[model samples]
Target chain A: MITLYDFELSGNCYKPRLLMSILGLTYETVPVDFYPGREHKSEAFLKLNPFGELPVLVDDGLVLRDSQAILIYLASKYDKTGQWYPLSDPAVLAEIAIWHDFANRITATASAARLGLSMFYDVDIEAAQAGAHQLFRLLDEHLWFGEREGRDWLCAPSHPTTADIACFPYVALSEEAGVPRQDYPAIRRWLDRVKRIPGFTVMSGVFPAGPAIEA
Target chain B: MNRPNPYLNDHWHVVAGNEAVASGQPFRTVLFDVPIIIQRLADGLRVTAALAPEKPLPVLERYGFIWTSLGTPMPLFEIPEYDEADRRNMNAGSLGVAVSAPRAIENFLDMGHFPYVHTDILGAEPHTEVKEYDVEVSAERGEVLATRCRFFQPRAATSSAGGQEVEYVYRVPHPYCSVLYKSCPSDENRRDVIAIFCQPVGEERIVAHMLQSLIDDVSTITDMRRFQQTIFGQDKPILENQYPKKLPLDPRAETPIRADKSAIAYRRWLSQMGVNYGVIPLVPRVADV
Candidate 1:
């Protein structure tokens, strides 16, 4: 069984949890009190992730840090369809890597604003919110054109890839940081599409989308 | 410090789609700045004001929407179009807009913005004029109505084959609810009814729920919703960037021309009803110290 050094409220920790759930893999969560307790900064947890992040996954004696890296590792090793990571297609692989980097940028801006507001972290809240809006503008436009072109997921793949999972949590939780998704209707619709993915689960502040109207 | 409730306590708001309140799962939402929780039990879904879970709020399921009234409210207004068996009923899903609920309702009632805000999808730059329309208050029915409006569009809706002349009727059945009846692309005699129900989460925030009841057999529910989402997505940014977050009820608060009849009538109706939940209360200018 895999073990996750997790914080329930942290969006970074939610990344691996979401992927693991989607892949239908069971894992044990070792709760880390990241807020008031500040346990992720504890000396013991640092041994697992020197970066002092909320999510550190240990699977079959191979320990991993970084939510994006864990998503890649999990998808590559377990996804039988090869659609999540798609190592077989070099071009798709390159596109997924680029989005993963973009996901980090989301963490720095959207997630940072959230932390500053909810956790009382020292950050330029205005700058972070502004930065998030700039990124969101690009994402909304890309998704809008993608919809017109009949593409659903972030990358060119017909189905969702790990990049969707990497970027979702922060965007979904951006409201807590005083950055509303109101202006990004495409992004909001994308969030609903992401939630409809099988085996989807929610972290705090991230609610499930209503069922799509059917026949 | 204590604060007065900023929401119109007596109005009914669409909180979610009926399908969203599934069994064994709880859905959370804030209406009129009050946190609410809805749970599906063996009998049916139970909705309560979050702070007083034991005290159940009045709930009604209609038009494929689950509605909750935080305070005493009259029965929901009837939409006669839904009774037609040939019509397709769809819940187009909820949207969050940073502007006030009243502003969203006004946007729904305004056709002047179609050429500019909605662009080629609903209208084109060449046809920016909103011709004169009739507006009146039906005191007996307790609603505001605008009629005899026509506009040219490149793509009227998702089902549009190409550009066509579309007739529109805008109606406000309640303070936070606005409905539109537009000419159907498929049938000349039939019209499609689209309603936008706004939930004022706060003075400057709203969650919009849409329902599309149309006389179209060719399109799937998903297709209908996709078309609405795309149109609303285009309007999101413009709605968020409006200078004053609240709807200014005073006519002098903002200039109004002939095309703004619907919006003008709406503001007058809201002011007469004493609904200030999302209206910007005019602040007196304190002479600069």
Candidate 2:
């Protein structure tokens, strides 16, 4: 049995939950009140994760701290198709690794802006929103060209990797942070593609897209 | 602190689609930051102040939209094709954006972003150029019109199967509303009417209503809607990320290019009309300062 130390609203927490859902793993959640309660920073929670983060995944005596590390472990173990986190291709693996780091940047900027706007965190909102836009512009350009080259997703070009899952949540919730996805048309289309991914679970803000009509 | 412009309050803004509120069902929406409710009657629709239940607001049903005004409004704009039975008049629905209404209208009037923003659907790279267009302000008609515009598109419409040079004519009939008359896919002699009515929900937020009246029998409603929605979806992010949220009416606010003739004319029209609900205060030049 697997367990996730979760916060309902946190995009970071949703990352592993999304991967686990896609992997068809039945995991229980220990809901941590991240906002009013601040339970993640408490003494008991501190023992689980010294970083005081919301997501500390415990899989049958194996504990993981970072969301990316948890994803790597889960995809390696449960993804039977070998498509989500295929290990044989070093090129694809390197691409996934780079995007995993890019996901962390998204957390710092887009998620930070979201928390600053909605949760009343002391964030440099203007700076954070600007940073998020910068990242989105880069991602949009990447995806736009990728589509032209017959590549649909971020990594592997043919099939969606864990990179798409990792980078999705914050981009979907960007409007909550006062950042609109207006200029990034490619990114908007990509979001719809991600929402259409099977086993996609809905959180507080991210809703499922309508059925995609195939060409 | 948005000072609701009296001029804008007096103009017809599209509040909802015809199907937005059902008969006997109360539909809720906000206009100029004041939340209002729309009640659909057996004959037509009635809008009332949510807080003041006794007062009935001025409402009109026209061209697949339910329009209302907070104050006494001028006449609504006209699209001649709506009256035609052969045209497929579709309400592409509404979407809320963080930018001011004028900004949304301006984005709709722009064709330069096709290659970059819309990519392969509306336009592709290496074929990027907005040919010169003629813009006019019809004082008698109370509208700003731009004609003789053209752009290369990969897929101009859902019915289109390949690339073609699309001709366009843009019109700004109201401060927050702009309409596009583009080449119809099935018919070479006729043009499709696409409009974006920006409802100024707040000073810096708007709900854009897209209505596409087309001369096409080849495409289904689903395909047409998906095509227009895809185009608008691409424009949303660019519109929201624009700084200040509100549009700058002053010609000096942003540099103008040959392709921005319609945008420039629209700004000039808004300035002439004194519509200031969602615009920045004009800045004095260095020489004047």
Candidate 3:
């Protein structure tokens, strides 16, 4: 059995849950009050995670902290389709690693700004929003050219991988953080593609798009 | 930011969807940066400003929405088709858009961004031409009307299966409200009505309320909602990134082309009304000049 210490609103917590849902892996969540309650910072909770961050996962006694690490582990061990974490492809592996890092930058800036604006937190909102736009420009250009060359995802694979899931939540929730994706048409298209994934689910503020218009 | 602008204050803006103000529950929202709360009393909904809870403000419930104003407003505008038979009228829901009300109305009037912003749904590539359209502000009715607008769309509605040329007629009855009469998928003789009633939460914040009245029998309400939401979701990002975040009433503030006829007319109408709440007025600031 897999147990995830989760906050309902935390995008980091959602990352693992999304992959788990897509993989059809059954898991239970120990709900943590991350907002006004701040249960994650409780002394009892500190034993589970020293950093006081959310999304602490324990799968059959194996503890995992970071959302990216949890994703790699879940996808590696349970993804029967083998497309999410394709260990056989060394190039794909490198590409996924780069995007995982990019996803962290998004969390630091986009999620931080969201915390400051929507959630109560002492975040440097202006700097965080500026940082998010800088990263969005790069991500948009990469996806824009990818479409030109008939590539559809963050990675080169025709099929979506964990890289797509890793970077989706914060970018999708950028609006709540006041960092608009309007200037990035390619990025907007990519978000729709992500929503159309077979097992995609939605959190608050994130709604599903209708089925893609048949080409 | 919660200062007075009589032109807008005198017009109705949607505060909440009628369903949102449930009995025994209090619904809170902001209009023109002033927080207002609505509670279902024994008689009806009692609306009051957050700061002045003692004094009750007036509210008109109609068209699946709750309409309100800070001052005396003209009678609500007419939607003749709303009373017609055989239409599936719906409150498609509201989205909090982070842009001025005028910016949202401009985007709603624009057919030019159909190909780029709402690609493959409202429009597709290579069919980007926004054909010649007629735009005018009615002298007697005091409304902005744009007719004969046409565009090729890949999938115009949830019921649409393939591409088709969609005809459109745009109407702006209120400064923050826009209505679109588009080609209905189920009926050729009739048209689908899509309206956005923007609540000016602040100068740069809007709560866009959508009302869709369609002539479709095949598509489920959920499917229709997702279709409309998908289109607006696509537009939200593009709308939010507009440079000033406020629509400039100055004709020379931003460059325009023939394709921007309806939007140009909207700016002109707003300027004539002297709505200064969520727009950069036509006159330049002396310090900047």
Q: Which structure among the candidates has the greatest DockQ? A: 3
User: Candidate 3: which docking quality band?
Assistant: incorrect
Candidate 2, residues B83-126: lDDT per residue as tens digits? 89999998875766778988888888888888877778788889
Considering TM-score, where higher is better, how would the candidates rank from best to worst?
3, 2, 1
Candidate 3 chain A — worst ten consecutive residues by lDDT sum? Answer: A30-39
lDDT on C-alpha atoms for all candidate structures: 0.83, 0.84, 0.86
Against the true two-chain complex, what DockQ does each candidate achieve?
0.03, 0.04, 0.08
Model 2 ranges with Cα > 4 A deviation: A1-160, A163-173, A176-215, B283-289
Q: Which stretches of candidate 1 lie over 4 Å from their true place?
A: A1-100, A107-215, B1-7, B282-289
Better TM-score candidate (2, 3): 3
Choose the strongest candidate by TM-score. Answer: 3
Indicate which candidate wins on lDDT. Answer: 3
Structure candidate 3, residue pairs in collision: A182-B237
- Stretches of candidate 3 off by over 4 Å are A1-83, A86-164, A172-176, A179-215, B2-4, B284-289
For residues A81-152, could you state the per-residue lDDT of candidate 1 as single tens digits? 899999989999999999999999999999898776544467898999999999999999999999999998
lDDT score, candidate 2, position A117: 53
Candidate 2's DockQ is 0.04
Over the stretch B1-289, how does candidate 3's per-residue lDDT look in tens digits?
4464787788877998887778998788888888999998899888889999999888899888998889998888988898778788877767677799999999999988888777787888999998999999996788999999999999998778789999999999988898899998778899999999998889998888889898888865655665676577577667777879988998988999999998899899888888898898889668878
